[model samples]
Target: MHGLPQAEPTNATIRPGAAARRSPGWRISRRVRIGLASLIGTFALWWLLTDITGVIGPHRFPAPAEFWAAFVQIAIDGYAGGTLITQAWYSTRLVIMGFLVAIATGVPLGLLMGVSHRAEALLNPAFLLVRPIPPLAWIPLAIVWLGLGDAAKILVIWFAAFVPSVINTWTGVRGVDRTLIAAARVHGAGELRLLWEVIIPGSLPMMFTGLRLSLQASWTTLVAAELVGAFFGLGRVLDAAYRDINPPMIAVAMLAVGVLGALTTRLVAVAERRLIPWRS
Candidate 1:
């Protein structure tokens, strides 16, 4: 019998037309991989310098292993008048509340400013002046007006987040192409319809960028806000650690704040991609 060569298993050959796409969950983006690797490398360097080699003393900077051990205990046992979870939750909740408020107020004002000269004239001077002032500068006034409570903390976070949101939203709208507007009008789009369908969509990328900036501001200023009148939070933990000279506790709080900030930012980024798939 003449034997014809059997072809390699059909599945082994790559298909000719388009490559198969991976589902979102199945794909880890390159940036995430690089960032994780960088974190690990940085930790390795930190461990070698502080824990293993003893180039830096634990008294000054807790060794990575030391920090890990303490962190485990912190998770189980409450410290500095609040459990670790309580501290984190308090700060995270405040950030969420304040950030949403900022977005709600800022985006509209920004859009109005972009499209209306009257709105810009009314708001611009105050905005420009306030924008440059440090958000923390209001702490003394906040304590006097709102006291050391949720109000003061929320106000601080709000101020921190508001600037970036307004700025970015304004930038996004102002940067919109007038030509695009004209095209939409030629197609009989009404002013309100065009504003919603054209301007808002076009400005989303910038709006999202602003939102991220606001989110960062919200969290970063959280500690400063908590410093005034907080019973429990990372900020309180930090203050206690400073007074007690506890480097490990300081490191733990810092790490938690940073990791939580990263996670929140990632969540917002996912929303950005979903809400504006065209940007992708």
Candidate 2:
């Protein structure tokens, strides 16, 4: 008994596969589960309300089934000789052009405003006044000046997008840490070097935020422009459906618009992630 080793407590032993068992399942967090459940519940409620209670007539407010049927038909047969696919392409192209224009002009102007006090003083009041005007309010002038063509639509979309982008980009650059700029100067960094290496990188997150806002604004304006007068686009299809008093078609068009907008939003988010990887 004097030389014998004492036994270790069995309860203190670590199980070989215990960690494996305790590993998270699908890593599904509570928030994600709740969000998914909420979406499903919303769809279920919508289906029940529209299908069961004929509270609104089919012509006025069609059922979900009716809208789905119309969507399928449009997908297969096309809308007014052009399929939803074609209309979507047309709308997408217009949005891209307008967005590109806004980016090209807005970024440089925003940088100027952020960098130079004189430029900011000269332009800030003009931007404040112009930004407040609704894109829809510009419709009549766009039509008169650019005609009821692609130009009018593109201009409207550009106007809707430009303000947010410029404002956000300007804010981002202006908000850069002053101490960082001072440090850069103390290290013998020139104005160009400081801007290119430090300021631009620091301002990128805010610029991306502005770009996201601009994309949404542009998309909304595109629809409004198309609704006013256009031969092709999702908005035009909706307009035609309205004229025909076809609630089902209208609902289908609405769904298409929602889907497209969501897709664009996701695209912007992806771009933001890639461009601003420093952001959490």
Candidate 3:
């Protein structure tokens, strides 16, 4: 016993405090729980209104259970010429394709107009002249010019998304701090370097705002474009529902749009948070 090492203390086996520190804090976890509870409560209220109380007839409004049932049935059995997911993909592809093209061209052109006098002189007036026209009004003209294919729909969405992209991007670039630009120049940063290092980062916040707006525009325009003549899309489903006066199908499409919009907006917020550490 004299030479034996003492046994390690059993008290040192673990630290509950350390584990607690790694877990979420009360405020954040509580807020998340509350938000989820509120969402479920809203759905529950709708269910009660239609099903239990019958104050709202099921014909006029499907219960939550019935709506979800219809959703699943459409997803599996195929509605509006294809399954719900299939239709969603058709709409989503159109939105993303047109939205991407709009931002790709619009943001760069906007930045150029903001920074270059010649570009602004040449492009600004025409842009100002055309931008105020309603996005949906382009649908008929696009169909005539591009034909009633995906190209026409894409053109419509592009017009809808492009305006917001250019306007916001221009605002961001034009609002860049002149002092920062001057400082970059004084520090021996060249024209390219000044733009890359000073202007772009400063303008990212506004550009991100534009992206959110473009997202909304893309969705709204896609729905309109689809209504004109689409083989498969939520808008087409809504069109049918309108004709049939099918409340359940209408509710499904409406809910789908709301959910998609919320999720995408949340994703953009997350991306902004991660990408722009300076903001936080």
Candidate 4:
């Protein structure tokens, strides 16, 4: 055994992270568990306050049974000659139309402004002038121009969505690394190629941020947008409920709006993940 060299340890002999690989781990995360518990506790508290103690009356806040009854009434008996589904569809349709229009125009304009100083100089003044005005302010002009129809509502919603999209996109594009752009130029990449390959990719994260904001803006503006001419929408339902002094109906409509906003925002997140797979 004198002067004999020892054999090197093989991977088969030493397995790092073997325990980690074997462990099933917690299937449900702590955050998720806490969230579930919080929701359950909140509902329990609401039940206690409303049903058990009667401290909160149905006039102020509907009990679970009252809420359910209102939901059924709207679902079955309908509201303003349109069922809940019909109203929801109308609102969703308006949102989609306005949202699409906003992105279609806003993205290109933002990109152009970001890429060319001349474009920014020419447009920035007007953009700045108009951007500060709230979307609600446009309602009167929309009514005068497009009349009391879907177009007017869409216009208002478009304004709501457009500002953030442009601002965010422009910021995103401008924020792209100058070094990368210069490197791309050194590699003989033309303006178009540089924009497509580098600029868009670099800017996508902020662009998506803009998109999410735009989506929220669309939903937030929906109720106001529908105020003028909409005969059937969640906004209309809320308005009608308020007019009729029906607290349960108002709660149901508000819940519907909240649910729809959440669903749409989720869709945008899904799209962002699909398009920007590299983002964590």
| lDDT per residue as tens, model 2, 98-181 | 988988888889998999999999999888888779978998899999887899998998898888888888999999999999
As for lDDT, the candidate ahead, 1 or 3, is 1
After superposition on all CA atoms, what RMSD does each candidate show versus the true structure? 6.5, 7.6, 7.7, 8.3
Q: For candidate 2, which ten residues in a row score worst on lDDT? A: 4-13
In candidate 2, which residue ranges exceed 4 Å CA deviation? Answer: 1-32
Give the per-residue lDDT of model 3 (tens digit) for 133-240: 999989889988987678988899899999888889889998989999889999899989988888888888998999899989999988987778777788888887
> Going through the candidates in order, what is the number of backbone clashes in each?
0, 0, 0, 0
| Candidate 4's TM-score | 0.88
Per-residue lDDT, model 1, residue 203, is: 92
lDDT score, candidate 2: 0.85
Model 4, runs deviating above 4 Å: 1-27
Stretches of candidate 1 exceeding 4 Å from the true structure? 1-36
Displacement of the residue 77 alpha carbon in candidate 1, Å: 0.8
**Candidate 4 — worst ten consecutive residues by lDDT sum?**
4-13
- Sorting all predicted structures by TM-score, with the top scorer first, yields 4, 1, 3, 2
Q: Is candidate 2 or candidate 3 better by lDDT?
A: 2
RMSD of model 3 against the true structure: 7.7
